[model samples]
Target: MTSPRRFDDRTDAGERLGEALRDRDVDADIVLAIPRGGLPVGRAVADALGVPLDIVVASKIGAPGNPEYAIGAVAADGAVWRNERAFERGGVDEEYFQREREREAEKARQKAERYRSGRSEPDLSGKTVAVVDDGIATGSTVRACLAMLAATDAERIVLAVPVGPPETIAELREAVDDVVCLRTPSSFGGVGRFYDRFDQVSDADAMSYLKTDP
Candidate 1:
């Protein structure tokens, strides 16, 4: 039989995750969560650490007919990172990839503005910012977020997540100051499969998390 699924909810899991980070001595100036699902976890981290919580909106450009398979991801300001293997696997050519990227870039830009909603992004200059996410599966979106963070002059950029497979975590480590991942289960299938209630996080929900200042 399969082992019992872990975590009760995002908050409970996040609190446990926050405690783990504290134990590991992972501290930061602020906790920036990739919007929607990440917001709930980021809220717990920020609250546990007594820091502000913010959202960094990013979008994944997935291969057609395989929405879960990310070929690339786009963040605000038009930065993107493509997975060559994904392109090859998806049978996407350079011309098609470029065209798709431009389309997704615009979507990312629009999504970012919607998430920001006139809220000013905190200046990362001289600040140690912690980038939090609910989890990582493909790492494409996380890479995009890291790319955006890199553009800022943050003194330190930390990637924190409740869970991720080992391979993806390893690939992501090179992009940030430090990665604080709590769980890397061998049976990792997807982020949603690990969550008890992995519902779709709407833009309104994302904005609510930001508006709550959690």
Candidate 2:
């Protein structure tokens, strides 16, 4: 029997993921990381690929009475990705979903503005863009972010992550041109379980990764 694989930290996972992308010949024009946890990973990946790093923000719309359970997600620009099955299971009504969507969209917009710090959104037109994240669990936010990217004029979109559950990864593949995930565990529990140091990242620390020298 083999022991399950683990990553030392987000940076470690990013380095490995970067190498994997290189090995697969993934040529990205820019790297867009989902903050606040994806910044460190995206910084490492951007450094590895010698490309600029940016952010794509999204907020999950949690189900009623289950704040941690996401029924959908909304992006900074108001793009949304809904999980119909989760909505049905959670007994989410259109009115509740619409209300949560507006609330979360504002949250995502504010977060994106804070992270950008006055910089204009990058022009992904005719560019190959890679979307990075620390890892994925339910992937609600990632889906919302991807939906926003798909609305852009990007020539190609790639999703890069360190680890995720097999089913989520498979579902995500249809949302992007390419998916470069380092590990897809069959019996995955959560993203944190695969990391040795899965500490929550603060906005300050996360934003620092966007610095040229950070």
Candidate 3:
């Protein structure tokens, strides 16, 4: 049997998340969504908050033989978030981790450039930026993205998501200025479990959301 869902879809979740942010009185200067699932959610959030939407790219560095298991993540700007426990469990060495980080960082950079389509990188200096994603699982990529943002001159960085596990959300709280997660289920199996319509978002469709006027 399928699990009960809290959201009809990504857009629905995003709308609800936006409302939550408004209730918190978060005055964000921009919304940066993690593609490709984050764009739809970010679109709704940007529209609701009357701000411009953009993309922040990150790629997961998986375990050596298990590509599905993320041992770490790297951002477009080369900032990295290493899962030390995963590394120890997987027996991943510095050489392998460094190699994967470099490779994945390049891929992330290319993806960001493609999504931007010649637009220069936004100046986040002294701005209140909200980072949105569909949800958080292990939060590897989100951590890497947050690490990148932390290195910037931005005054505040907020992480907004539709849902996440209680433990993950608690840990993420320390990484950002504020968090605006709508749901933090203790029995979470996965991010898709809380969504009735969790579909894979294509690059083209995701990019279209960025073009939407907020």
lDDT, candidate 2, 114-138, per-residue tens? 9899999999999999999999999
lDDT of each: 0.81, 0.92, 0.92
Over 21-44, each residue of candidate 3 has an lDDT whose tens digit, in order, gives 898999999999999999999999
Q: Ten residues in a row with the worst lDDT in model 2?
A: 1-10
Instruction: Write down the lDDT that model 2 would get.
Output: 0.92
lDDT leaderboard ranking: 2, 3, 1
Error of 3 at 40 (Å): 0.2
Count of backbone clashes for each model?
0, 0, 0
For 1-214, candidate 1 gives per-residue lDDT tens digits of: 1224576667766787778778878778888988878888888888888888887767788777777778888886667888888766657767876777788778877877787787777888989998988889888888988998899889999898888998888889899888888788877888877778878878787667777673
